[model samples]
Target: MDNKAIATDVLAAVGGKENVTYVTHCVTRLRFNLKDSGLADRDVIEKIPGVIGVQEAGGQYQVIIGTNVGQVYDEVCRVGGFAHETAVMPDKDSVGKKSILSSMLGTIIGCIMPLIPILIGTGLGKCILMIIQLAGIASSDTSMAFYVFSFVFDAGFTFLPVFTAIAAAKHFGSNQLMAALMGCALLHPNWTSLVSAADPKFIGDMFGIPLYGMSYASSLIPAILIVWVMSKLEGFLNAKLPELVRGMLTPLITLLIMTPLSFLLLAPAMGYLAVALGDALLTIYNAGGGVVIALICFVYPWMVVTGTHSTLAIAGMQLMAQTGYDPFSRTLPLVANMSQGAAALACALRTKNKKFRSTCLSTAFTVFFAGVSEPVIYGVTLRLKRPMWAVMIGSAAGGLVAGIFALKAYTWMTPSVINVAMWIGGDGLNNLFVAIAAMVVSAIVSFIATLLIGFEDPTSDEVEEGADYQL
Candidate 1:
């Protein structure tokens, strides 16, 4: 879709490359840390071709660009001569202006957003493995073929701490190598063995104090927190340490001090905090029943809109570890995502402009298959205004049905048509059917509602003035 042209327009609209401090993207949005947000034209940027929506949240300027965000991001970087390899942290001045909560949210989003592509690929690989097993093509989990694929796909999650550490290190402006080494220490075979062993002696005592040994595989909080502290320590040391000794000694001192603090203090404390939060969410889910589930589904798209949905990954991971499945992941695709796709499809059918129709169709395809809804939500529904109500209505209806049926996902995969097979073994074939039913209900409802409510057609002038229409 002329990605280079779109990138040029985006760069210009945001007040040229000089106005940008940093630029990065998630599944569907180009997140920009602007030097002066006031200088950029949000409305004009929103109207740009290929741009779906623009939001100022968490001290960042976000431009929604659908699934092609990565391609567009690459072009944006190329046009602006920005480095994609380096992490893009918010400016210190920007952080100072934001509340603690906003700053924390921004930090979490920045650290985790970079990992989405790899996570999606691995999740899909795991789904493929499940499909093979379910089809009886590979009957045994112990088969050599299974083992090979399993390790290849599972390694990402198994060593997730390392990736998180790298991202966190970049976000916090720390030594990446040292941060990665600390992550490795958390998942070291020797330490993991000690924790998994039957005898308490394997963990042994440290200065008459029993060591708390917990496997850090697939963990999020500890890796992020540890690296943050490491970054601060390294920054302090870099300023104080002699220039001649800084290179080698800084990493050495940081690792020596941070490692013990991580294992003996930070990891255990963060681990407990994760568990407590997960337990609390589960408790609320149990107590509130179908009403809570419906509400979550209705508000899920809004969460994605504000970048708060990424936080759920932590709770979803912890819940999977504890309960062998996570209902949150399952419910989202059936209701929130399906409804968004449906609304996009409605826009495509109802719109007369050929270009807008094509864009809506492509967005619908991404939402239905990839399970990313931000583009559809921001680009089409939210922009059109009335269609958003249609999506919510459809989502609430579908969520009610899913909650009533008690549909849950067995594996930790993003909810999508590709991962529908994951529902097969955990909740029986009936649950899978119910999930399908939920999707159908959401899509039909949203589509019909959008058609009924209708939206303003893009005028020739508007289309020419700005590429505001979804592409």
Candidate 2:
């Protein structure tokens, strides 16, 4: 479809300006919150030239338009007259069951995305807190100011379930409130404390089916899937039950069916599967540390192009939480992020396209300083083949070095230059310095390579390639 036609069709499908609640973009998807998902014409929109796929995740209908997603995102906002930010609750019924890879990515993005803004805010808050505590303005041992800082910083991680439910419900196409309610089951004060206790293995059963053994804290997969199923069950009951009883019956039926099935069957199996998979991945990562890094370096940027990098990150986090350090642990992601930033900076300097240059510059700065990389890869690096190759080579080289050094990160934060704090877990500043050094080297190398080889701007034909935000 032509740009104008594509824009017009998308605007119509999302139900004119009045229906649009919010609009946002990720690596390769235009995420929209509409008054109604029913108003969207998914089939037609998916056929758009730039469209790669259509999905409803995180309570938003995402139009995947690949690498040029930002451009199309702008187009979508322009045509639809969406404000820069809008609070739109996702429809719970939007999430679709996914493959192992999809689930892994979904989980990773699920955990991190909801926590990102909080992390940023908390990071800044922690910085301030540390400064104050060190300066004697606040006592770390016993002070209200310290307590306040602790809450703000710990809130995201502590009540992660609430955030995950909101995001996962959006992904699973379920009701956010319903999903959140389900999440509350796992997060409830008594339940959480009990679950955290390492009770002996017991084959608990609901309806005579043996339940799998597991804990729920720092978990993402089970609760997410459970809520999705619950939403489906609720929908089914709503349709089957009589009008008078539907209100009570729908929820009652949903809970009755879902709670047992989930706890007794699905949740246990999924938890085991996640643990096993996470463990197996770590084994492989540890086996050929450098080689694994090389492969990630090679594929990570492309994954970003396809909007699938989150799978790797999610897998890493799940494994990390279980094992205390994921096999794919260390400075690999940091290198990748830095490489993209470097490539973006290179593009910003070399390219003359005002829009492209500006986007690249902004992305480079944010990814480098703030640790958000989607903007760099989707908005800049992946658009240029030579620059992308530079990023890949730099990433691999950096990954290899990081792997050899056996770098590790303790905290879960976005991979960025400032995220160096994450590596300060065990020993002093050794790992942190290694991470910084590797990222710097990778960025410099990628920058040099990009300047040497050069790249092409997206042609007019290529513009339509991202018409649906598939990148």
Candidate 3:
């Protein structure tokens, strides 16, 4: 279906555009903050042609649309005439009533969801480069091809603050350009040079406060915190200043005040918190070992349902910065995705309904190859009820093996079969073998379980017409 038609169906399912307070999308879902959640037809939305499923969680109505969500989101914005920045902001009354935890999760999702496309693209580029380097196709790391490819792949993570700050500003109702400049300040050549210096004294002082130099490259928490504060400061300044000078003066004053504060307080504080959280998670993984990993895999689908899976990305990034690799974050998720896909494929093989079978096959391919699992999970597994257990069981089996082998990813990438190449250089052949083993094991186990467990085939009404469905 065309984007406009999809948008129209989506808007109508969600009780029309008037009911929408805001709309945004992550990698595979369109998240909507509705004025009245009751007005939305959840069952109807789930059955929409392009929609994978519907989720009401984290105080938002989420429509799962697989990987094409970005295109649909753009169309939704156009059709609804809702500004992207304002679309995500909650109603004023609802804001004060939200719990601290909900507010924090919402902010994190807002800031990070916008960056997923770039993150995935750069991550895959890095993976491809690694494979080429490993194959001796690009022998010299010093070669121009190597440098160019490396920079192209590495720049996204290396300069994450710039992207994150802009997103956070939009989320927090701040000046985007000013927020972007604040991010640039964190990565400024002068600041970076001081931080790179061997001696502590080289960092000097900023406005009577000591500058404890630290690199903000690939850092998430610091950029988010800095921008949140900047938003508040900008709002205050804009309101208090005269209309004529406000545009110019608000940003200038906000930057001057925030830059010093960031260097002196925000960066250090958030950096420590991020480290502590990452360390705590690492400690838990080390202590619990395979059992913990298995449990994570078992419950992962539920996390995705609750819209809390994005939290893992934040933690994983921090862990990667602190340590050279992230073992806990991406490993089990990869297995779970493959398992979900496997279950869907099994359903495809067993189902008599040609249309439903076709959808199952397509979604299976999308999940297994592209690592987008929502379609298979929501459209098939959860819809069938029996396959979800099979997926979890298979995922747990794979997670156990992964944890026992201590499989790790050297870089931040979306966990998928395509990302298996990333395991090559850092951890040697054993880790690569383990990753492959995890995929194979999960797929086989889930396939077998789904076939044995069985599910009721969809009725005639449930089947839709479309051979070209791409999940």
TM-score per candidate, in order?
A: 0.90, 0.72, 0.92
lDDT per residue as tens, model 3, 315-385: 88788777868888888678889898999889999999888887898888888788887877777888789
Evaluate residue 308 in candidate 1 and report its C-alpha lDDT on the 0 to 100 scale. Answer: 68
lDDT of residue 72 for candidate 2: 69
Q: Considering lDDT, which of the candidate structures 1 and 2 is the better prediction for this target? A: 1
Worst 10 residues of 3 by lDDT: 462-471
lDDT of 3: 0.81
Residue 431 C-alpha lDDT in model 2: 72
Q: What is the lDDT, from 0 to 100, of the residue 430 in candidate 1?
A: 84
- lDDT by residue for model 1 (50-96), tens: 78778777767888787788999999999999876665555666556
Candidate 2 per-residue lDDT over residues 176-292, each given as its tens digit: 777777777766776555555645245455477655556665666777678667766766777889999887777777777777787677777777888888878867877987777
Which order, best to worst by TM-score? 3, 1, 2
lDDT of each: 0.78, 0.66, 0.81
Candidate 3, after superposition: displacement of residue 264 in Å? 1.9
Question: RMSD for each model, in Å, please?
Answer: 2.9, 6.8, 2.5
Native-to-model Cα distance after best TM-score fit, residue 148 in candidate 1, in Å: 0.8
